[model samples]
Each structure stands twice: as structure tokens, then as C-alpha cells.
Target chain A: MERDDIIEYSLDTHHDEEAGKKIRKKIYFVTVLLSVVTAIEVAMGIIWGKAHIDVDGMGWLTIKSIFIILTLLKAGYIVMVFMHLGDERKSLRNVILIPYVLFIGYLFFILLVESSFIFYVKDVIGWV
Target chain B: MAGEATKAIDQAELWGGGRSPFSVSYGKMMMWFFLISDALTFGGFLSALAFARHHLEDAWPVTENIFFHFPLTHAHLPLLYVALMTFILIISSVTMVLAVEAGHRMDRKGVVKWMAFTVLGGAIFVGSQAWEWMTFIAGPDGLLSTSADNASLTSNPYGPQLYADFFFFITGFHGTHVLSGVVINLIVLIRSMQGWYDERGHYEMVEKVGLYWHFIDLVWVFVFTFFYLI
Candidate 1:
């Protein structure tokens, strides 16, 4: 089959070796980034999860917050890079990602707030 | 009169929409749409878990304490296995994207190799999840059920009984996804070897499947954080 018959995405570029090498390098780079983030998260959970070290006035940099933030960061990178959203047009990226972010925020708000409200009611009213 | 009216409608513009609307193929667009919905489903489940734990409050099982057992060793090791599983999934996701990249280059050999690794990674992860489920169900020291009526809120020793229920349900649901991903990946790997994508002139199938695989990996990241780390 003729080479021209095959369609080229960024990786091919009419059989350019450098283009293929560059794409391969990008894949490994992402792998390293994700591994580092996972290691950080696991370390945080292991080291400070139970320590509860308090800051003077700023409140404790709780392990929970660290886990959430790190997880979100990892998730964002995985979505952007692995799913190829980062290479997509800005408008396409926004169209796919923004609404999910909004929905997740809304879901978290409701569940967290309502749970606290329920906890208060149950404790105060002596209800099961 | 009818021919003139039809010509006025600009038939070329009406029938042909030029390039794809989002400049992505139909398959990729649909995959994104499906993943968005799937993400919400997972988000809902995780939020429900948070709600249950919050309601249980002080009675909720300390996640670290509950998931502390490492395989073969009796010593309490918090998040060790779960963290390993997360790494495996992340590595598999990397391989999957590599496969897609190889496909973009029309490198048949590279696609097969990377995708096979991805399938292997996925199989291992699913097996590990099964092991986790078995270990969890068996409980530490073989205490499967403290009593027959274990569901009762009053007599439960392990905080709220809902903790175990949620743990099983959420992880089981996610495990099923991983299982299906493995199957789908295996199919894609085989097809690549058969020159399926090469015949089609593009490796978009690999890209589509890669999207799903990465989404599963992404979900596991959240699950690992909320389910075990927290």
C-alpha cells in the first residue's frame, strides 16, 4: 500500500521519525508525572494522615484536603493528556470538560452540606 | 418552479456540513459524551458514600484502620495495596495512550505491543480488585459476621454496617468497569493485529478505546482518594 493512502495524525506526519519520537517522549513524560503525583499522595496519607499536626493560626493542613487536591490534580492531568483533550481545540475542550466540573461541584456541595445538616438534626433531636 | 425552489435551499450546504462540527470524529465525540455521563455516575456514587460516612460521623470506620492489611503480611499497612493498584492502573493508562499514539503513526507493531501491555495491566488490576474484595469479605481474623443480625444499627461493632456495604458496592462497581475495559482492550489489540485500523485508514478506534480506558483510570484515582486515603 502507498504511504499516502494512510492518514496522518500528529504522530505520523508523513513518516517523520522525529515526530514519532516526540510523541513517544510525551507519553513517557506523562507517565512519570502521574507516578510522581501518586507517590506524593500515598506518602501524604502514610505520613500525616493520622499525625494531625496543627499550624499556629492557619488551621491544620489536614491530610484530607491534601488527598482531595492531589487527586483532582492527577485526574485533571490524566484527562487532559491521556484522553488527548489537551491537544484538542480550546472550545472543544471546554465543551467536554466544563459541564462535568460544574455538576461535580454542585453534587459535592449538596452532599456535604446535607450530611452535616442531617448530622446536626440527628444529634440534637435524639433521632436515629 | 420546483427545481428553482430546491436550488434556492443550497443543497450542498444542507447535505454536507463540511468538516465534523467539533472537528472530532463521530466516534470520539460520542465517547466524550458517554464519559461525561459516566463521570457523573461515579461522582454520584462517591458523594453518596461521603454522605453515609458523614451521617455515621464518629461511628464511621477510620478508612486507614479498616483498609490497613497488606497481602501475606499481618502487619497493618495503610493504603499500600490500594496505592499499588492505582499505580498499575495509571501505568496501563499510559500504555493505552501510547497505543493510540502508535496508531496515529500507523505503526502496527507498536500498537499491538503497547495494547497487549495495556490488556495485561488491566487484567492484573482486575485480579487485584478481586483479591481485595475477597480479603475484605473474609474480614480480618475470619470475622465474617460478628452476629447473624449484623445489619442492625445497634449491635454492629464495625461502626455503621453501611461502611462495609458501601465499600463492597463502590469497589465492585468500579471493578466491573475495569473488567469490561480489559475485554474491550483485548478486542482492540486483536483487531490491530488483524490490520483492522490500518484497513480503515486511521487508528481512531484505538483513540476511542483509549478514551474509555483513561476514564476508568481517572475514576480509580478518585476512588482511591475517597475510598481508602480519606
Candidate 2:
């Protein structure tokens, strides 16, 4: 096959060694970010469980919410950066992310609502 | 009449040509669609878990108690091993990114080296998952099953039966994904070594697989928070 025929389309503009080095540096930065977040998560779990640090007036619900938010931050970063969605066009990114976000929100709303109803029916009203 | 014919031909050409409406390669676009659907599936499972946990309320098992063990150390190390696994998977993602970057430059040697490391990282993760599964099934004290229907936690201190059920099902499903990821990475690694992508003069295959591997790690982040930490 001819050289021209085998060349595939790509968004990478690494035409030289210097560009490649810069890309590698970006990768290391992402790695460090992810590691730091994971470390924070683990530390939180330990302090809450073992050290038993009691937050004044903050319930377990508040603590759990913090964990959930941090987890979402980590997930968003991985999808945007490592998956390279950040480099894609704005329309493409919106098209891919909007539907999933809407669906997940709907699912959470329905499930949580239904679950609360069940709790009241079973525990509060004493119905099976 | 000639002008009308030309317009019709232009429309036909636009429709028939292999063009990417989103300006992305067909494979990458398809990967995005697949990931969106897969994310919904995972969301469904996790929502069901939350539904169950909400119903059970205080009856649900506390995570820190159950996942406190580390390899070779008897002391309680809640979430330690899992944190290490998360780190390893994240590092592998970094290597996969490097491989894709190398592929962009048509650097065969860099691609080969980074891809090999990516495969090795995937293998280690799968092994770690297997060990975790073994530990989960065995339980800290011992197995306590009243019937063949399921593994019962009647005797264990890890709360009710439903918690075990969700733990096994969710983590087990995630483990299967990791296992398949390892196999896929191996195949890609072998092909990279053989210069398959080198011959094609593009490393889009590495990018596609990197998308998948990163997705697996992303899901684990949620699973870790929901099932272990929270």
C-alpha cells in the first residue's frame, strides 16, 4: 500500500519531539491530580471511621454528601481529560454529556422518591 | 435541467460519502455512544442499590467495617487496598494516554513501550480484583449460608443479607468489566508490538481502547464511594 493511503485521520499535532514531550507533561499532571483526589478520599474515610472526628452538628448525611461530590469531581476529570472529551468540539461534548446527565438525574429522582414512599409505608404506617 | 441534475448529485454525494458529522472519526463517535449507554446501565444498578439502602436504613452494613483488611496485615486498614487499586488504574490511564500521544507522533517504540506498560497495569488490576472477590465471598469470619439461594450474612457482623447481595452483584459486574478490559489491552498490546498500527500510520486504535480503559476507572470511582466509603 502507498504511504498516503495508510495515513489515518487524527487530532494530534505532535509533528516534532518537543510537542511529544509537552503532551507527556500534561499526562503526568493529570496523573498527579487523580492521585491526590484518591488520597483525600481515603483519608476522609479513615478519619471518619477510625479517628471518629465528630463534626459539630453535621450528620452522617453531610459527610456522605461530601464524599459523593468529590467522587463526581474525580469522575468528571477522568472523562474530560483522559478521555480527551475536553479537546472535542463544544457541540459534540454537549451532545454526548447532556443526555446521560439528564437520564441519570431522572433515574435518581424516581428511585429516591419511590424509596422514601416505601420507607413510610413499611416503617411509619406499618404496612408490608 | 443540467443545474437540477447537479444539485441532486451533490445531495447524493453528501449522503453517500463516509463523512463524520461530528468531525470525529466514526470509531471514536461510536465509542462515545456506547459509553453513554453503558453509563446509564451502571446508573440503573447503582440507583437500585440506593433504593435498597434507603429501605434498609440503619440495617445496611457500614462500609468501613467490612472493607478494612489489607494484604498480609491483620490490622484494620479500611479502604487502603482499594485506594491502591484506584491509584494503579489511574496510572495505567496515564500510560494509555502516553501511548496514544506516541502513536500520534508515529513513534512506534514509544507506543510499544507505553502500551506494554498499560497491559501490565491492567493485568495487575484484574489480579487485585480477583483477590478482592475471594476475600468478599469468604467473608472475614466465614461463610454463613442458610440456603443455596445466596450467601447469607446472618452470622457475620456485616448487617443484613441485601447488603451482601448488592456488594457481590455490583462489584462482581465491575470486575467482569475489568477482566475484559485486560484481555482487550493484551490484544492491542500484541498488535502494537507487531507494528500493526505502525503500518496503518495512525494510532487511533490506542485512543479508542484508552477511552474504554478510562471509563472502567471512572466507574470504579463511583463504586468505591457508594459501596465502600459512604
Candidate 3:
């Protein structure tokens, strides 16, 4: 291949004035969304604390689960938008992330198994 | 035959340019790969924390209480210090973005100026983290008054040793990262002022460093949420 062809293939010339404006606007929108969601999460936590209703159907576990989900959503938005990972090719993004995801999965597996065994030994066997 | 082989070798070297399939500049590509690995490390830590929390279900300490401490006040305040840390990190990230903008405009003075602020922000963050660590390790209300204190690693108002242990390990690991990031930013800022990459006619180095700095800040955002807010 010619040198010019190689340069043409490798160089990125995608950014333009209009594209820049659009990206800036998108970034602002994402920021507003993140802030609004965060506020909602905080408000939910406060309301839960103040009510102390114990809402027997769902229980405390359910409330905690909701909080965790909201937290993950906030984190996802930050990574996808603010970090610009959402703009990259899916393959490139996955290539950069999959290993960490797998390793974390493995770690969680070990923790679950070990913790259960310990719990059984302590609570059932009176080993403590 | 020998002449033909030499010619082919020259063509290969010229065309390949010794670049990998990624085809990105060495610095930017390496930074991205490093961040990928670093992200995994943090994810592993957080998973371990979650597992601990799940297993010890009944005994997890309220994170708000553990992290809440006020400076120069007798009253115990929760979540304020971590909030301040978050602000510092966000401001540093903003400064880094400004530096990248300066690089794009080929404004050497602007790059240096923004990078200096970025470094300062990182340094202040590290300092705050040190204070946070001191507060954590020292134990609130001093080491001697264990009973007076609501919670200690040895005994929590809520639960077991696992909670305190995880808190210390997770936050300490992140604090160490912040400390190293501060050092790295300081080096980059000094190099920028010295015109190291300036003469090369590309500020790609600033962009690479900016990416690393932002990744650090991004990781801290998750850390703050998982380890504190959640």
C-alpha cells in the first residue's frame, strides 16, 4: 500500500465544528441527568430513613437492593458519558473491560463459597 | 538473491513502521491498556467487599457513621470528608480537561498554567486523603477512649471485625492510588513547563496523562460510592 493510503487509514479526521458543538451539548445533558438521578437517590434514602415504616412486603433488604441498583446506574452513566467509553467501538471497549469483569466474577465466587462455609461452620456447628 | 532480500526487508521496515495493529501512538495506547488492568484491580477489590457484606449480612456497619468526621469540631459529622474528596477529584479532572483544550490550541502557556492547577488539585486531594487516613487509623475520640467512641475496628456499634477490615483495606488502597497519581501529575506538569513535548510539535503526552488522571478520578467515583454511600 502507498504511504498516503496508510496515513489515510490510520489518521482520524472525524471531529468537526458542528460535531464538537453536539458533543458539548450531549455532555451537558449527561451531567444534568447524573445530577438529577443522584438527587433522587439521596432523596429516596432520606425518605426511607425518616419513614421507618419497615414496609413488610419488601423489607429492609428490598430497600437496600434498590439503593444498590440506583448506585450502579449512576456509576454506569458516569463511565459511559463522562468518560466517553460510550463513543468507542464496542469491540475496543469490550476488549478493554472484559478481563476485569471476569476476574471480579471469580473473586465474588470465592467470597460467596468461603463465606457460606464459614457461616455454616460457626452458626450450625457452634464452632466459634 | 541477497539484493532482493535486502530490498524486501527495507520495504517491510518502511511500510510496517514497527507499529502494532492497534496503530495508536505508543504513549496513548499504553495508557489505555494500563487503565484497563487498573480498572480490573479496583473491580476485584469492590467485589471482595460486596461478598464480605453479603456474608456478614447482619453485622455490616453503617458506612456513613464510619466515614463521618468533622474537622476542628467536637461534633461528629458523617460523609462531609468524602464529599470534599469527591469535589477535589472532580476539580482536578476539570483542570486536566482544560489542559487538553490548551494542548489542542497549541497554547503552551495555557497548558502549563492548567497543568499546574491540575497538579495542585491532585496534591490537595492527596493531602485530604492523608488526613482521612489519619482520622480512620487513629480512631475517633482517640485510641484510649474505646468505649466512649461509638465504633472501633475491634468492636463496631453495628457488627464484626470484617466491616472495619474491609473499610480500611478498600479506602487505604484507593488513597494510595491517589497519592501515586499526585506524584505522576507533578512529574507531568514539570515536564510540560520544561517544553519536553512542546518541541515535538504534539501535545499527545498531555492527552495521555490527562486520560490516566481522569481514569483515576473515575475509579475514585466508584470507590466513593461503593465504600461510602452504598
Best by TM-score: 2
Write model 3 residue lDDT over B1-230, tens digit each, in one string: 12122112223323345433343444555678888878878877888787776656556666565666767775755566677677777667767766665665566787899889988888888788777766765655545454534444565444577776776677777778777877877887888888886686667677777877878777776776667665
The sequence of per-residue lDDT tens digits that candidate 2 reaches over residues A1-128 is 21222212333334678887886787888788889988988998888742364433366667778888888888888888888899776778999989888989888889989999999999999989
Give the runs in model 1 whose Cα sits over 4 Å from its true position.
A1-15, A50-61, A125-128, B1-18, B143-157
- Rank all candidate structures by their DockQ, best first, as comma-separated numbers: 2, 1, 3
Better of 1 and 3 by lDDT: 1
Off by over 4 Å in 3: A1-59, A113-117, A124-128, B1-20, B143-159
Ranking by TM-score: 2, 1, 3
Taken over the whole model, the C-alpha lDDT of each candidate is 0.77, 0.77, 0.65
**Residue lDDT tens for model 1, B32-151:** 899988888998899899888776766766667657777788887888888899999999998898888788778899999999999999999999988776666655454556554332
TM-score of 3: 0.76
| Residue lDDT tens for model 2, B31-115 | 8889888888789889998888887775776677777778887887878998899888888888988888888888888888998
Q: What is the lDDT for B1 in model 1?
A: 18
Better of 1 and 3 by DockQ: 1
lDDT string for model 1 (A1-128, tens) is: 32322222222223346787887788888789889989998887777664343322233336677778888888888888888799776777999878878988888889989998898889868677
